[model samples]
Target chain A: MRPQHLLHQPLTTQKCTLGCPILDRCLGGAIPCNSITELVAESGSGKTQLCLQLSLSSQLPASHGGLSASSLYLHTEFPFPFRRLHQLSTNFRSSHPCNDHDPCDNIFVQGVHTVDQLLDIMPRIESFIKNSKSRLPIRLIVIDSIAALFRSDFENTPGDLKKRSSLFFKISGKLKAMAMGFGLAVVVTNQVVDLVAPDEGINGLKVGNLGCLYSSGRRVCPALGLAWANCVNSRLFLAKDDEFVHQDNQLVNGDGGDFVSRRTRRWIHVVFAPHLPKLSCEFEITRKGIFGVER
Target chain B: MEISRLPISASQRGKLISAGYTSLSSLSSVSSSALASDLRISESEAVEILKVASRGSRLGWSDGTNSVINGAQNAWDMLHEEESLTCITTSCADLDNILGGGINCKEVMEIGGVPGIGKTQLGIQLAVNVQIPREFGGLGGKAIYIDTEGSFMVERALQIAEACVEDMSEYSRFLRNDVQACQVKIQPKDILENIFYFRICSYTEQIALINYLEKFMSEHKDVKLVIVDSITFHFRQDFDDMALRTRVLGGISLKLMKLAKEFSLAVVLLNQVTTKYTDGSFQLTLALGDSWSHSCTNRVILYWNGDERYAYIDKSPSLQSASAPYSVTSRGIRNSAPRKYCSDHQSNV
Candidate 1:
């Protein structure tokens, strides 16, 4: 038997569209299946909003770039955004009137407070998927902000670091295997932390390239260092920058440009992806859902 | 070959053999500390055993009586090989001149810059230009482009390939007097087809794909250029352990260097720039810290020079430290026309 043939088969060719045409196009059609895609950003950048939007979209019919399946939303950050999910469901209902089923009814929400709890739930999730009573198969598994579970779990000792990294690999390894076996799309959210540069002198900084990544205007890197970074198949960075917008309504002529208002501009950057070029596009989060602004 | 053959104490030999390190080759890669822990011996005794094993292996090699030293080449032969090494052009005249005709094969070259400084453009240009027929003074070989940042666009590659085809046909017209050189058999589609694209999602996959390149390259011997578009993206993220990151990067660089030499192909590693806090302020430098600087045979830093894209040879053993102006034109990397001096232009990180 040709082992190469089995290995070369395109395993992750399916995509669950983000529901917005421009955003989907930016992500090369949609969130690819059989891979772990991470969303990293500071708070209020709409990482959870996007995940909520995805939970609803995954329930959409296959013709609309969905799996026509259910989603498992595992949240580590508090009080499941029930109201926001409700608002999104109403919009989803209006958008696709043909589907009479409640978009919210299909989503399975599980709150995890600690790292041990999250790890313990892995087997249950597998069993749930294997013997799901619902008509739709679970095609999406989302862990909203994976960094939260590990934030206070371990201290900064070498042994603790090793243990934390091993746990990271363990979780991701299981997630990857589940994704490949079940053909599900795994979306994990990660928070960002202020990057503290090493105080090592100029020569020290030059000895090891400890460069920093900037999001919005602040110098921040994704929470959970390189070990977690290696676990995700793709990383999407969301940033918001406050910009002064000209208040054109107050001006009678083009010269009256002194009146301005401040507004936050949000952008989604493809930090790294196997199928995407390094690209970024502006997006907005409204009551309806997240939509990509055409450039 | 066996552990018993080592000139070590009988008890130590018994422990090593019982612990399953029965051969010298198996013990070769094992560290003394690890061997000591596994065999329940002191570190000093493990070291002695390792020393004797190495000596025994050396004697075994001599007993074989091979004429040539294994994998060793004299300096004179190496010079001849280096002189004949081929280079894949970036298609920009000034960039090519400073790059010593073009990006030299059998060596690893790292090119890094800030976002949108045309690193991907240069990578794609080289991927297309590598396929330029030998008649046109090119390598006429295939290219393997490993895109880590998803920055590689097929539409952009297609456009560059079309432009490359046009350039070739135009050159053929100039060499019309030489009847054999006027045949432009390659097409834009063919150029695109010749490029094998790999989309790497994670650092592990990136490392795995790089390791797999040896077997892949052996199968497709015509692959003369390996382009890794941004090797630092995954390695720079989420890594809290600086020591492990350094060791991982070092191993990868060694593998890449070996692949370059063994396959006689150009290995171009595209890198991203990171902000470094130095002298009480943030300064933009290439990603993947200082130790990674020694990984490649050549390092080229791309930056903005008063509204013009310039590439500076930051480090190279043979090439002089110099900078040249280039541009990312619609047709891909090309020579930039001298622009009016603008003092306000600052490096955009």
Candidate 2:
């Protein structure tokens, strides 16, 4: 097959049927259906929340700029939160009113424990996708993280690197091929590691007089180093403010109104992407899932 | 008592190598009399060899370094050629003047700034600007941009490239792709095609790219500029061992210096800043610490003062430390005014 088929225009240049509300913020325009996009951040930066929202959003009909299809959710790091998924689906239904379809039926969830399990299950999933294409819409694929298994299995040993890197590349290569071949929106999440200590604060937190008080960590780049970083086409960094609060969905308005109980603001910084400029937008996690905070 | 200087035979050197005494430091660490018995050399000669090895390791390179020694007249001839050496204009005349007419081809210059201060923007502009034709007072060459932080934006480069094409009519003679058309319209796509872009994710990849650069440069001789966007990002973050990182950084810098001098290519190294707590408030400093402070031939500090962006010449042997104001816009980096009038008004104050 000609690689020319793989060189289709990015979603930014094409008219996206899925009118994702926050598309202009994190992503420049539409979801790049032809390339692999990585969302990397520290813990509790709302990566899973974004994935949940995407899973539901991709289920919307094609008239609203969605693939009106199913998604394959691979949770490699943490337990799948079906409760949160239901809440987001409910919120999405309330907003659109017409998209009354049971969103869960459209999304396929799989939990794999080890790297070997992931590699083994991937081909089966690919074939299943091929067979199920006519039955349902398979739009997006999210591996909660591509790094969890590799980070744990590879013990910083010189001997394990060759094996580790090859596996990493193999997995990414498959994801890329599947995304291009099937025309899927692939959103993978990655974790970040502390590079060095930043300037000292009152108690290890660096305070900016006018801005947010982040921790004194010098470099908080994504984990898995450069080898895995180069594999993805676009990378977005999620950072949360130091203000932390816990509340229930009783505070969120189903009509996308003002939030009653104060929610911690999360920022999604587009670290690097081909079409998007370097910018960040404030977002928040509610019972409904991640959304751009209405100013 | 350097063994070779003491008239040691070739067989004795071979025996020393076989015994695992490969370096002077390793040899000097052992007891001389005990080593003498082990190597079957005379006691006095062994003692003398140990002493000389210790002195050699401790003292400066009394032995020759890898660099060649040139006479003053020959060096003066090089100095004369340096005057006509092609420098890449940074688009801002004042900044270029402070930079001694943009970036000198035979020198490695560093531009340091914090995360969002447009250090990468400057590097990208230089890469795009390198394609300006010589007839229009441009470098008339291509660029090699090695992006380490994954910060190289092709769309942004396209924006800057499109902005550059607005003024392409005057420089069309040096940049025309074909002789068939008398009036040529420069395409931004052609400018993008001229730049050689390489994105590296890890420190190992960065080192490998630096090692592979010589062959690549020789093959692409039209590339007159090399831009390493934030050299410390990979080295600083991935290396758990600080010493190893420094050693690798040193090797990379040395390789860059060699590449600049040998190929007559200008090297622009973008650096991220570190935060240093000084006088109660935190001050921004260059990352990679002092060991790397001396690596660049010239160092310019990019910082924000109140509203406008200022570039200060922090270190240069031939020029005094001075500051010039510049701004980041859709048209790329340019003079902050009419800054000549603004600075004159400020100087009087």
Candidate 3:
């Protein structure tokens, strides 16, 4: 029997890399390639930024912390952070002059507003993979944020958490299959909510559910908490440093109306990374991207 | 490619295999006409192949199908006992002790409690525990968390990590010293596609997702647990075509149960509480309907007493339906012996 025809080899073991230098080290490699790697955090926690960077980085070749692979970035809530992404990309290109662009040519970005759109494009994505003649490779895949598409795309309106989750179950499955078949890495960002404690227990907080919000109690802890934390091969929780603790006093010029701080010291912490031995790492949001700093 | 002694094409052998005529008994019993019809081959050819096989010459082809089935069942039973596949223990030692060493694979343990009862916290803690090494009795695998409530707090995950590392004695430790909170990978994407291995499937998607999940389980084979914090919300939102609700729920439940069994992975589903209109009093209800309830081996109902206090029980299957009082502390579920809030009146009913 032909090797491909023989079913001895399982297809789910392909590993992809996210382009972040520090992250790649922590993960031992980029998010284990073909596995579903979830990046969850509260809003403004740089989840989208990480997703964008991965989309762009998946195009880089092996020598530059990338797999010379292609990627499909699905967007829902916000417009592609084009200007910021462009800035990050251009800056990386300028900094790494030796790195060429053809490696990234395979990377594709798609914006999806609803679940139907996402499903509709899945076949097309497969076709793209089928038709591509390039040996450049396609490895990383990302869903900027799945919550928006879940909330706005479904027919059974909100207020029903059960149906929302059911819809998501279907969606996640398709993405996972695509990732597995193509040996591509998947990175998805999720939103989080605060809780009002009735007492000391952690479940005291109220949070959203269904349509990918991830319930409060069952989900609230352990590196993004609950089902969100439970679903991925690995998960990472990112949070900006508390302004009071890390804000740069030098940035506080006491001018420019309410925003006078230049060094408002924003830091991203690796609140969760399971496979990597290091439980936490600190990064400063530099002009290039999240720059690794001593934790 | 070099060891072929027969002139028959491989496709022919595949056809014969699919036709269920691999053994002498079956091949002999099947008439040439029936075999021809099933195999889409001429009756003469079917008879010829059967004759060759019936000659009893050592072709190594005629094996009893019953033995094959029995072999498969035995292997499945052995797999069913894979040690890593078990329910994640809650912080409550007593509760974990009762739960067959904390959460058996192929069963859905629903943790349903009112708000402020620490359902999320307990679930998070278990997710972490499930990843602990086997010496601690954990399955030592990653956790897949579906967060609907958005209360997936990283700080709490950090706290739990800190507690877990601290609680471990020098010998019980499975993690490295440099382990920081950053090591826990967390993806907060809302898209179902990004919800780990699960897919955001519709009716058609569900079928596709199930096939993919089966394939995925076969691949990872290490995943010992799956946690759908709230399985209810998704169904309630997506299945507005109420007519399809039962069908979808049944299909999903069956697939999940099968997945748990095949992969030897524990399934911990967090359920929501619903109220009945008759008494105008609130009752905890799993979002999934009877299909899900019946499918689940263990259905737990959690309710709050307005504070950190909560009540729960193994609600169904009648095999294990005892109510237990557990508190959701910062550490995790604290199912201490029996608490004041442990209502006997509720259990008597």
Candidate 4:
């Protein structure tokens, strides 16, 4: 229980022992364990998609840089994209050799639609993780958007601000407790609100100056503002820039309208974290899952 | 009253006045010690002069004449002013539908786009449109257009107003109403007169103007729509320090919000887009980024795809993520011409 006892052995050096290849680069080395790591992005910026990936990756055998355990995915936003998951897991297993268990069996899915339900399920999940009766121990817990239920249930009325603040604080405390106590990686996703200036000229179309230390006039910011922002241990922001769509790459007008599918490339910005540098990496969603688009 | 016209001696007045500090509000704001140091007068004398200058000007409430409940009740009445809680329509029915009826009062709505994407045109159009009579489906309120980047175009506003008048004329024609009556209410000159325009050149001035707005707006009670055509222009270029810029911008946003709610007015913030470079590439991001992304109740993102103009509901309290095709015509922003038989097109038509 002492501070020194906490810093011993496997804990002394923090590394993703189940070495996901891109973790070292994308997540600033190791999918940080025992901390609430937030992946925030605009809708279709692939927050859920990236999380689906980590769930599959976490289920990979330890030799493949996975914890060789199971993932507890508490999907709050949407019915967990089962078809997409099936497609991804099928593709993942084909590419990586799997000796025994089905990947689906390892990923535990729970659908939570209310704050009370989310709160009610956490202890059950903890006891489930601690029961030690299962073949695979839980190594990762993915909360696909921690904000949805809260946003829907709690109106930001003047009276409810304090209530919202308390609720926010409590949620953060609980997530931190579960992650740190169980020594598992708790990954959560948050939605972003558009912060872009409503009025701008198209001048300097191609050249974007990172001259300012801050995000250059970026209005699209993660939701659940500062109070909830304070609760998460590490935060990563994802954005997709479809601005560079080429004329040659245009798809055939399937809809028979001007609706040509535009290709978008996403960038993951390491918003801020104790372990990670405040930097970003370009990535794309392929049939294979979220792959970092190497420059 | 001018400080020079004050009862004080000419020499004393000359000593007291510093640039524009002769104004009572400015004088009241400075500490007596600071004023004394600048004017070479005793602190007591400075206080007396400031006190005299502020005569019959808004003195802070004394102990017993007013009760807190009186002020509270007045505020309660002002906030619940349902008649003023109207939206200034952008005139594009489909876009208006997604916006829950268009740019609304008592909230800040930002629209971002790359330069020359009709952000200014929309802003100018709103300023003109806000003046339309309430009976004719407009807010029937004055507008304040703060042109930060010199983007406010009077010519374009006139053009939009002309188009509005033509439309109003058509509506009247169908109703068999008098042409002169419609012309009187929807005239281009009257729309221009209702829109109070001001040009701001710096972040400091922008802040100063916003700070002064609470008082300015209180005096001009009819002004219901406040448009800062491109809010981030000076703030982005001027503030090199991110934290400082965020703080100043936050302060301005809060002040604007307060003004919006207090006056039952709509605050339309026009913003420019900035590029956020990540990894090896850059993406177009709204200016001021995440730091300011959530203050607005709704946001409409006007963007171009292969030379075709579209407005996307980037964020809203009620609407789903949707896009409405629109174009910048000589008459200002109009819904794009309906296409041949897409189900969406039929509904839009």
* Fnat for each predicted structure, in order: 0.00, 0.04, 0.06, 0.00
Q: How would you encode candidate 3's per-residue C-alpha lDDT over A1-295 as one tens digit per residue?
A: 0012111233223334445566666555556554466665666657777776676666666656666766677778767777887777887677667766632455566788776788788888788776877666556667878666654444543334445454455565555566656766778876655543433433443222111222222233322233333344455656554443334444467554443333333333333332332244456666787655644
lDDT head-to-head 2 vs 4, winner: 2
**Which one is best on DockQ?**
2
- Taking all chains together, each candidate's TM-score versus the true structure is 0.61, 0.57, 0.50, 0.42
lDDT of each residue in A56-175, candidate 4, tens digit only: 777666556567778899988766799998998888778776445568878889999897787787788878988956578987888888878777777755435435655655665566
Q: Which stretches of candidate 4 lie over 4 Å from their true place?
A: A1-295, B1-84, B176-183, B339-349
lDDT (tens digit, per residue) of candidate 1 on A1-295: 0112211343236789898999998887778887789998999999999999999999877778899999999999899999999989999999899988898989999999998888898999999999999979999999998999998889966557657866776788678667866879999999988756543332122111113445668877777765566566678888898888876763466675567788889988876564554567899988899999997
lDDT for model 3: 0.55
Q: Which of the CAPRI classes, incorrect, acceptable, medium or high, describes model 4? A: incorrect
In lDDT terms, which candidate is top?
Answer: 1
Candidate 2 residue-wise lDDT, A134-252, digit = tens: 44667688899877877887876544664565566567666756775677778888887774554343223221111222322335556775446545667777787555354444445
Residue range B1-349, candidate 4, lDDT tens digits: 4466566667778776754466556776788899888888889998887776655243222422222233444445454664446778888877787777888888888898764466777888788778878767777898888866543434446668889878777776777666655554557777777777765645676788888888788888999899997687565442447788788888888899899878888999987665454564546678786878866667888876543567898988767888887765667667876554434643552
Cα-lDDT of candidate 4: 0.68
For all candidates in order, the CA lDDT equals: 0.80, 0.69, 0.55, 0.68
Considering the two chains of model 1, state its CAPRI-style docking category. incorrect
Model 2 ranges off by over 4 Å: A1-22, A25-27, A30-51, A55-81, A87-295, B1-76, B170-185, B276-283, B337-349
Each model's number of backbone clashes? 13, 7, 121, 27
